[model samples]
Target: MSNRPITPLLDKVCCPADLKGLSDDQLKQVAHELRQEVVSAVSETGGHLGAGLGVVELTVALHAVFDTPRDKLIWDVSHQCYPHKILTGRRDRIRTLRQEGGLSGFCKRSESEYDAFGAGHSSTSISAALGYAVARDLGTAPEAGVGDAIAVIGDGSLSAGMAYEALNHAGHLGKRLIVILNDNEMSIAPPVGAMSRYLNRLYAGAPFQEFKSIAKGAIRHLPEPFQEGAKRAKDLVKQVTVGGTLFEELGFSYVGPVDGHDLDQLLAILRTVKTRATGPMLIHAITKKGKGYAPAETAPDCGHGVSKFDVATGVQKKAPANAPSYTKVFAEALIREARADRKVVAVTAAMPDGTGLNLFAERFPERIFDVGIAEQHAVTFSAGLAAGGQKPFCAIYSTFLQRGYDQIVHDVAIQRLPVRFAIDRAGLVGADGATHAGAFDTSFLANLPGMVVMAAADEAELVHMVATAVAHDEGPIAFRYPRGEGVGVELPEKGVPLEIGKGRIIQEGKRVALLSFGTRLKEVREAAQALSAEGIEPTIADARFAKPLDEDLILGLAREHEALITIEEGAIGGFGSHVAQLLAERGVFDHGLRFRSMVLPDTFIDHASAEAMYAEARLNAADIEAKVRDVLSGATAQAARRA
Candidate 1:
């Protein structure tokens, strides 16, 4: 280890402006130090480790070349931005990365001037950069000095249609934009699609140095007519063989298949492209995920994101109990269902492992589809599978599903296909923070006509819901579950489908009734227990289907109880909102019945432990108890005054 600490160098950088004064050598040194800092910081915080590590050199090269804060640098997905964050004045608070009230794990424009655009989802960089480029051309802010728009997108993100859409538009419009294709052969998983295959073929060819030298010499000696003819011939050859010809045809000047890890090669190529290339340019740089760490390199999953681990041993800290995660439960249930039915198939957007479909993939390789971070494609593709008489379970995180919202509405709901959506991470996702939070899926999906939306109250309920989704072939059905383990519920041999639009009463009581949905059942139970001790007995009902609204159960609860509270693990427009809307529509509130909605606060919550994040959002037992007490006290006061 180098004894010289990089603290001083890192401390001096408040933004990219400070980096402008540093020499190339210093920048190189800073890049190395930044990597070290990232490794060290993430060892404590535990976030998207591999991505940040992979982008160390790229981050250094970009800042060293572009006048950031003036020249826009939009990082695709933004997970690979720890090094960028370190160099851009946030070093002092780096340890607080992904923690509550601390620095965000991904790039945030509000955090600093250097973060030209905010991103959490993949494949949005090119579009964002194009918008910036257009704004510059239209003189959106003349005094802001928007010099250039650069988009750094991963090869995995290239599989998305949105990325291609942006590329097509950028090429046609002839905007002065730069797109750096970070070809790491992985995007949370191995890259997929025709583009990935083409890029691999390009990588297999001879080095760019040899090709460039040969082309330069051949072009220099030819006569004007022959030169033009040779240029046409060379372009024809490029079109026949080079994968980048597609980008070129799209109107971008294509460059490289360069070694991303080589500092000199990267800088040299970047400098050339920065000056020589006109209009839109695509610079393809090949890199390795988890590049520096030996354990991460050898890990089956590339150590994409890790829990708190020992630096020397790479062993994660063990939790006290051994419980299967919600994802595992869902996968196991799906596997059981699939084994029984030939029509069952699984799909994911480059997240087989994260969505718990790896077990299914291993067992039924032919039936599994890893669509590579293209959520829109995954949803529509599943709709196609459903149309073909195959039962498709599109397992995607709730946050990622936001990207495919339109497709879900247009392809699945409009046609009323029986696409089973196994919505994972259906609530506040810790560490990855606001961008990755599964907040809006419940709300968004619930509103779509003919959409069947349900939330698992526990792990066992998740199993049952999986069964329900598989059995229900009437239309698009979705079941959401939170991240992490189930509440140690006993495993069921197999799941049985439940009645549609029905709710079950968990505990019976009197004066007040609590309508709980999703994982909030535990908190509601806890609050009920505390209230029981206080002589305020409450009834509990698990409202399974958000869309169906369990009208009879809700209306009965409304009429029976003095106060009815609806709780869910989502944002404003989710389960709670739907319940309120349903009750209001039926004139349930016309009797002046007291009602309260427990939901995630309107503001974005930062990354932390799931429990800590929930508590901060005031969605925990204590918070629920407080709300119940407040509502009860108000009701009591009103009754006493009336008497």
Candidate 2:
């Protein structure tokens, strides 16, 4: 709190309406203060740093130019909404970003009325904004009406197919909508694909830029009668170059390649578009990611995602790791596999570094493919690679893999292609919140026929799972591992592939059984220790495969124990659901047995520490101990009655 920034101009701005009467110069000062404020806030609360810094001016300009709340303003991905949050009455809670019961890291509609639509996923803004535009038109009177629908989407987000689909639909509808293409030249990783190159060509000094400037400047000076002709001449000249003509063909009135940081330019263009444009309009504003701070500007990824850092030195304060992250373990293990088998290749959808495929790319440059924010394409491309006899490992985050489910089913699962899925962030990821949680991946993927699903219990287990995926060529196989460091277990020099559908018992005990899946094995072990303290001495087993339920092991456990409890990091329909189905099918439940399934709660858990989230979901070691105690207590009471 002592390190809080002194924001004089921004102090006056409690909301967007407060910026209404400020002069252009004062507004510029506000942008400067706002950028510093965002930097200070995010420095304390580690989150998306660069993206918010990149859009400070644009956020101020949009709020000043457009009537927000009434006029819907949607942010694509919404990682860049920090500055917008500051201006929209959430300033008080800005420092509480991504904490439990605090402000969310992304724009959440439930969090604020100013956030027109909630978005943690990318490329959905255009479609959502178009809906708002249509809704506005459908209203009978201005009193019940929406003013405007504006979507501020990044260039990286534009790489997704959904953005293009929305553009095509918006074009067809010809609704009154405004789409601001915030071309920052960087995403989580550097922007990829032909779309990024095309955008580069637009802003890159070509003959069109000089011509555009001269034509615009000359048009204002022209007599009233010649001004219309000169504007037509400018449009014809713009068409000569392949800059914004693609958007024009999409039925949008294309309006930029404008400087996003320039307040006067943004204000002028937005004011003109607000008053006159009838159909969909696209404002392509060029800006740098991590524009303000020198450290952020020079750093690779443009300091896209950062930990809590010192504002002065820009050095992040990261906790010392006890063990290698599951991501790194998977990457190193995959690299070892690839070295032995040249058929192994990697594919990522705009997240090479995040998925630890950057390590793979560094070693096997030619073997790695970055599909650039197109998960659907990445999945099918991996399927194609497998079909061509190459062992392709499609590395994607669990939450993001949801986007390519159709392709996963149609192209990979149906065809029975042996495309290995390396699912990172496979459970309740911290800070990013429920939208980014890998809660549903196991549930969704396990349901598909011929799909083999496995979860790693720790970093050591993750190494083996990677080896298992590499060894398996029967059909599509997936292995899920969570975010952050593993539980300090000594890793094998190299992973030895485990037999399919087999689980190992940690220890043999009595009465109750704890069937653990994924990273929750550590907690299960701790719970067992607590139970042992109480003289319960419960049996514990790690269920490695969710799809092929280690049938014999599960049945043996059910037959041996009076009460059985299954635990996993995923949602209810995941490992627990499969286990329950197996028990019911085997008629194990026909005998009087107390059973409990510990999984994530039905409601979405908000941003918090991993421990806090699991505690709230009642899947913590303490919760597990309590559940076991209750089950044992009930069993003992029933035995007394029978005796």
Candidate 3:
């Protein structure tokens, strides 16, 4: 408490209802205190700081003006929900963010009733808020008190096609919905695409200076009798602010590019919208990312995401780098490949930094594409590039890649377009939880015909896999690697492409075989070492390609070993399932062979450290050792009776 910022006003507020008691001036004070509290909490916990900081005033104004839980307030890509969470009675656990058993970094529906919709991925909020509006209009649950449905979406989130789809539909349906465009002009990476440019143009012109007056005096807010004043206001809007064109053309009554950090302006705008809004409306709020904090404002990415840092200096206390991250290894390997082949290009869906393609872009700016938050577009765009003869590596996080599945199947896989997918965060990612976990890409991608799926065992393997993806031109090929630092293996000076559809023998032994996939080979080796201490030298192999399933190696392992256990950092119907299908087809299972497939649990694992999550899934080193022992002990007892 000594180090904590004093928040006298914020302390009095337990929920949004408490905010309603405060005077408008008091609400401004609360916003000030709340920003400090958010910065202080995030400084201790190390989660998304700048986004939450930016929305401090918006969060306060929304809660102060509208009746929440009753009025569904949806946050698009709710990484900005930390301040919202603090105001909605989650402040005590605020410092526990992104930790095991702690609050989620994003808005979760189950976390609270105040969290109207769960949003991990961007551009879903408008759709959800529309659903709430329709449901309320139709009186689906009057007892639930579903009132005004408001979606607070960032301008960056607007880049996705879904937001516009929802906008178009809401306009056509003519439902009373509120879409607050929180335009900070930054979403993870700096904004991209036409939507970003259009938003900038909205703020750039002097026309915006007159938009607030016309917007505030618009017909919707006035009584039905003041019809002439409303018409005049509407005409004035058309004369200014791009003729109130795009959003107005879409059916939504477009509101101002208001000052988002101005508590008074936000309160005035929101109060008007809440009380008088009769149809779909879009409120454009201009706010600064890292609004109050000097460290975040000056830092690159505006401190989009940060490690636990000192409040005074803003210097992060990162662990000593023992090994380079897998992202770095992939970036360097891709750079090497790009150096060799000019056609080797990259595409990322608003995650150049997250996917390490920002590093790639530093060297090959012309070849790299940051397609904003539009994953579906990114996938098909890469397919177009591949069809045109350039070797396109569609680098995307495994979780986000789910958005582009239809494109992958229809455009890349079916067409045999030879598009390389550099799938990062390919396993249970820490902090972000089940919503952001890369747990299902293998199952999804491998199921597609002509799609080659491979997972790297270590950083060196990742280097080789990058080379392999660059070389593979037969069909669509993908290589997956998890988040964080590697196993400290020495990287090759240059990546040498590995033979396709082959598994490598790490160590050869007898009774039991441990077939590992992805970065779990590190754990498999540790388990093998522990087993060796007990006089059980297990056969260890790295199943490099999940889709291809090195048949010869798998068959040989089944023939030689008494028990075969397949391990992967993926869900069911992935690598282990493919191996099972192979063994069953070969009639290996008919010989009473002990087979077990280690996968992520059927349930969604919550936010935790990657190691802890793996342990919960029972795919950790100790868990592997136990599983091997359990399989062998049971097998040995049964064999003794047969002997």
Top-TM-score structure, candidate number? 3
What does the lDDT read for residue 555 in candidate 1?
Answer: 90
Q: lDDT of each model, Cα atoms only?
A: 0.84, 0.88, 0.89
> Which scores greater on lDDT, model 1 or model 3?
3
Tens digit per residue, CA lDDT, model 1, 254-293: 6556667767666766665566555887877778788887
Which regions in candidate 2 have their CA more than 4 angstroms from the true location? 140-144, 207-242
Q: Which residue pairs show collisions in model 2? A: none
Residue pairs clashing in model 1 are 14-89
Rank all candidate structures by their TM-score, best first, as comma-separated numbers. Answer: 3, 2, 1
Give a tens-digit lDDT track for model 2, residues 268-356: 76776776666787888888899899889998888888999999989999999988899999999999999999999999999998999
lDDT of 1 at 144: 73
After superposition, candidate 1 runs with Cα above 4 Å error: 1-27, 207-243, 318-322
